[model samples]
Target: MTVHPSVTDLMRRAEDAELARRAHHDALTGLPTRLLLTQTLERVLARRVTHAPIALLLIDLDNFKQVNEFLGHDTGDAVLLQAAQRLVAATRAQDTVARLGGDEFLVLCENTNAAGAGMVAERILHALQHPADGHGAEARVTGSIGIATAAQHHGPTDLLREASAAMRLSKSRGGNQTTLFDLRLGGEAGRLLDIETALREGLERDELVLHYQPIHTLADGSLKGVEALVRWNRPEHGLVPPDDFIPIAEDTGLIVPLGEWVLNEALRQLSTWKRAGVVPANFTISVNLSPVQLLQAGLVDLIDGTIAEHGLTHEDLVLEMTETALILDRSTMMDTVSALAETGASLAIDDFGTGYSSLSYLRYLPAKQLKVDRSFVAGLTTDPRDAALVAAVVRLAHEFGMTCVAEGVETPEQLEHLRLLGCDLAQGYFLGRPATAEVLTRSWAPAGVN
Candidate 1:
C-alpha cells in the first residue's frame, strides 16, 4: 500500500477490466448482455418478496435477417444500434435495456405489472415505427414484444418463459405487435420452438404431405380442378394446421424449400391420378405460389423443369398467385407471370378483391382467372353491396374473357347468388376441405356430372 503502482501494471489492469466489461455487454449497442440480464432477473425476483411489482419486455425485430441479407451486415448493425437507442429512450432510467444477441432486445422494468408492461410495450412499438438510420437509406423496423410480470409466487425462469411465449404469439399474429402471458395454450412459444425443429427435419423424414380441395363449376357442378394445400403430419404433434406453420415458414424463409416440395409432391400426385384414370386428362391442379417463391431467381425455370419432370402439360397445371404478391413489384411480377403463361400454364389471381387489388396491376398481369375472396361471398345474399361487388368482379373478369371463381359458398343461398352473378367456378368448405390423394381418388369420382 505504501509503494506506488507501476505504469505497466496499471495498463494491464485497465485492459483486463475493459475485456471483462465487453464480456458482460453488447459490442454494438453497449447494452447489457444476456449474462447481465440473467443476474438482474435473479436479483429482481429475490426482491419481489418485499418490493413492488416488476416485468420483463422481450422484443424481437421482425424480418431483420431479410434486411441483413438484402442490405449488408453494416446496415443491419446500424439498425440494431438505432433500435437500442430507441429502447433506452422508451424505458425509464430505472429500467435495464439488454441485447440478448441478434435482433433480440430486452427491458427489465422495476415496479411494473402486466398492465404497466403493456403500456411500456405500446410505447416501444410506437417508437420503433419511426425510421432507423442506416447509411443513406432509412430502414423501417418493427418489433414483437412479450411481457412477463414478476409476482411474489412466480419463479424467475417461469416468468421469463411465459414472456417469451407471449412474444412468439405476437410474432405469429404478424410482427410489430405485443401479447401478454396466459396459462392456457400451455406455452405455445415452447411448442413452436419444438415444431420449428421438427419442420426442419420434416422433409428428410417425409413427414410433410399435400392435400387437394376440389373446385367445381357453379353452373353445372362439374369438377374443374383442385387446389393443392400442404399439411404437416408430425410424429408427435399429430396434425399441425397450415395456419400455424405457414406463417412460421414464411418468416423463417423455409417457404422456399417447402414450396418446392409441395409443387413436386402435388405434381407427382397429379401424375398418379392421371395414370389411374381417376382424374380427367383435361383437369388442372392449382398450386398456390408464395411471394418468396415468386421472387426466386430461377422460379420460372424451376417450374418448367418440374412440369417437364412430371411429364405434364402446362394446361394440366395452374398456378394460383395471391393478389397481394402481385401488388409487390408490378413490372417484374408481371414479367414472371407472362413467362409462366409462355410455358402454357394458366394463372389465376386468388383472393382477387382482397389485398390491394390494384386494377393497374391486373391489366399488366397475364391472368386467366379471378377467384373472388370469401368475405365478399359471406354476405352476398343478405347484403346488396356485397352482391354488387361480386357482380362487378364477374363482369370485370368477363370483360377480360377470364373465368371467375367464387370461394366460401357454405349455404345454398350463397351458391345460388354466385350462380346468378354468372361466376364460373366455386370452391369452399361446402365443397370440401382438402383431402389426401387416396381419399380424393376413391370418393371424388367424376362420373356423368359433366
Candidate 2:
C-alpha cells in the first residue's frame, strides 16, 4: 500500500531531524558531543561582554577502568550510557552535557555562579549513586565531580583545567564526592605541594620517623602492644600528619617506598625496645600496611628478610590494613597476608566495617584481630543501634577467633562500655596518645630496667 503524500512528507522531515540529531550527539547515549557543548559555550560566552558568571564541571567515573577490565568493555559502555542518561535527567535543559572522552564528561552551566554549579555537581553525584538498569544485572555507579568558575584570568581551557584539578583533589581525598576550586586555598595548596616535595626526599634525608601508639588490653588495662605510626619530620614543614601527606604519597606512587621505610624503621625500633628492656621480647609490634605496599613484588621476601635480620619471631609482629584496601585488591591482599603469617607475623583488619566488604572475606584472610571503625564507637554513648552494632561486631570477631579492638576509645564511658562488650583491646587518645618512640619507650619501660 502506498503511504499518503502528507504522511510521507512528515516522515521524511522526521528522518532528516533524526540524522541531524545523531550528527551532533553520542550514538550510545544521545548526549551532545564535546564539539557541540564547546560551540554552545562559546556562543554563551561571546554574548557576555560585561562578564556574566559561569561554571565548568568535570565529571569522572572512579574505578571505571577496573570495571571495564574485569567486566568487559560492553559492560563499561552500558555503565557510561546509564551515567549519561542520569546526568541528562539531573541537569537543567539549559545546562550542556558532553562526552569529552572515555569515562569523563563535561558540563557547562551557563548564567550560573559557583554555588549554583556546586548544587548541580551534588545532583550529578546523587544521580550516579542511584541504581542503574544493567540488562538483567543490578549495579550502582558512583562518581566524583569537580567545579570551577570562569575567572578573569581563565579562558575556556583554563576553566576546564581547573575543573580537572578539582576532580583530582576529590580523588586524592578518597573518591565519590565533589570539590570546588577556591582561591582561598592557594596558600594551603602551595604548602601541600611543598610537603609532597619534601616527602619525596624524606627517606633519603632520614627525616621520616615512627611514633608508637600503645594498644592496651581491655581486661587488665595493661599494654599488650604498640602500633608503629609513621610521621614525617620535614626540616622546613615541621611535623606532617599521615592524613595530610599519606594520600599524596599513595597518589604519587610513593607509598611503596614509604611503606618500606616504615617497616624497616618499625622493625629496628622493635629491636631497640627489646634490647632496652622497654617491652617483652615477644610482644607484638604492629605496623600499618598500605595497599600499594601489599601489592608490591617481594613483599613476602622483604618482611621475611627483615624478621630474619631482627631475629624476631613472626608472632612478634602484626600488620594492620584497612578493610577498604582489602576489598580493592583482595587476591594480592590474601597472598601478602598468607606470606606474612608464614613468617610468624600476624595480620589485623584495621578500620573494620567502614567499607562495603562482606564479613565472609574474614575466613580467607590471615587476620588475628578486627579493629572496629572509630565512627561506630564514637556514637556508642547515645545510639543504641551503634552500641548493638559494635557489640555484634565484637561477637563476630570473637566467634571467628579473632581478637576485637575498639578504636577511638576517647572517653571513660566509651572504655567502660567496650569493657562490658568484652572488647579484646582498645586504642585511642584515651588509652594514651601516640608518642615519640623515645617517650613511648620511656613511659612504658619497667622501672630501673633501661
Candidate 3:
C-alpha cells in the first residue's frame, strides 16, 4: 500500500516546522535564542505606538569566566540553566527571556519604559543573588545590565549594541549594577573603543616615548634619580598624556604589554646613559607600576630579565606604585612586593596619604621609600595641617628606616619647608620639568661620570 502524495507532503512540512522551532530555542536552557530575540524585538517595535515603549536589556554575568575556570563546564551549564529559570520567573508573561550565548542573557519587555524595565532589572538582580545549584554545588553570580528603550528611531541592532555598551560601562564601574543607554554614553563608548585601538597601534608603531623628571636631593640640590613617565606621541592626537591613556590601558588589559614596553625602554635608556657616562654610578631610574602589571604571572621574572638585559643592577631600578595598588589584592601584592624586594629593586609607595589609610601595610610591605602626595606638599607653606602631615609622614618613614620624598614642590617656600621637614628627595616643576633623555643628560649630568 503506497502513501498518498498529499500525506507525504504533510509529513515533510511537519518535520520542517519542528526543526525551525528547535533552531529558534536554546537547547541547554530551553529559552529563546538570539534569532528569536531579534524576531520578537522587531515584532514588538512594529506594534509599539508613540506613547507605548519597549525596552531591551543585555545582562552580562560578572566574573562568570571564573566559574567556568574553577568548576567544570558541566557545572557552568547547570548554573546557566538555573539563571535562565530565575530570569523567566522575574519577568512578566509578555516579556521574552533569551539566552544570547555564554553568560549573557537578553530580556525584551513590551509596553515598558525605563521605569518598568528598571523594576524588572532589579528583580532579576535580586533573584540572581541567591545561590544556584551547579552540579550539586552552590554557585553565586552577579549581573551587570544595560537597558535601552525604543526611542529616537533605534533599530534592533542599534538597541542591542547600545545596551551592550551600557552594560560594559556598568562593568567598568565595578559591575553588578544597571545602566541606561544615553546618547552621550554611546559617544563615550565609541571614543574608548577608538582609544584602545590606537593604543595597540601605538605600541606596534613605537609611538610611546619616555620623559624623565629629575628627582633632587633636598639638601645638596644634587640629582637623586629620574622617574620615567610614558607619553604617547600619536600622529593624529599629538602627544596624548599618560593620564588619558593609562587608565584605558589598565581597563583593557593593554597595560600588561604597554608596561613591558615602558620597562624595557626605561632600562635601555638607563643602560645607554650609564655606558655614555651621562649619569653617576649610583644614579637610579624610577618607573611607575600599574596595578594590573603587579598581578601578572612571572612579573618578577620579567623584571629580572629586563634588568639583566640592560646590564643594570636591580638596586639601580625603583618601582613606584600607588597605595591603591596595595589594596587591590593584598596577598598577591604582598607576594609581588616580596619577590621584587628579593631581586634588590627598591619599592616606593607613590601618592601616599591619598589612598588606603591603614598604616598596617607599612609594617609588612617591603617598600624602601614613600612619596608624599602633591596635595600635602602644595599647601605646606600655608596650611598648618598639611605641614604637620608632611612632617608626620617623614617621621614615620624614618622610623621604618625608609626614605621619604615630597612631590610637587612648586615654590621656594615649599622647598624650604620640605627640607626642614627632613624630606630626602623632591620632584616638581620648580625643581625640573619632565624632559627628553638628551636634555636631562645635558643639564643634570653635564660632567658624565665614568
| TM-score for all models, in order of appearance | 0.62, 0.63, 0.66
Task: Give the worst 10-residue stretch by lDDT in candidate 2.
Answer: 324-333
Q: What lDDT is reached at residue 75 by model 1?
A: 68
| CA displacement after TM-score superposition, residue 183 of candidate 3 (Å) | 11
- Evaluation by lDDT, superior candidate among 2 and 3: 3
lDDT of 3 by residue, 1-450 (tens): 996679879999999887677558766778887768888888777777776888999898886656654654556677878889999999999899997655678999988899999999999999888988888877878899989888858778667766776787888888889998776765667776667778888999999999999898988888878999999999878999998888777654578899999999999999999898888889899999987787665789999999999999999999999876765445456778998998889999999987534376687888899999999999898999999999999999999999999999899999998898789999999988999888877765667633
Ranking by lDDT: 3, 1, 2
lDDT tens digits by residue: candidate 2, 324-438: 5655434445666787787767889998876544465677777899999999999999899899989999999998999999888899999999999999999999988988887
The total of clashing pairs for model 1 equals: 0
* Best candidate, lDDT: 3
Lowest lDDT sum, 10 consecutive residues, model 1, at 324-333
Per-residue lDDT of candidate 1, residues 1-450 (tens digit): 699789999999999998677657766788987667878888778866574888888899987765654555556778888999999999888889997655778899888878988988998999999988789777888999988777677665556556666788998899999988765556676676555657878977989988888899887888888999888998876878899788556534467789999999989888887876777788889999876566554688888899889999888888998865654333345667888888888999998776433465566678888889999999898899998999999999999889999888888888888888889999888877789987887785654213
Q: What lDDT score goes with residue 147 in model 1?
A: 85
Tell me which residue pairs clash in candidate 1: none
Could you give me the TM-score of model 3 versus the true structure?
A: 0.66
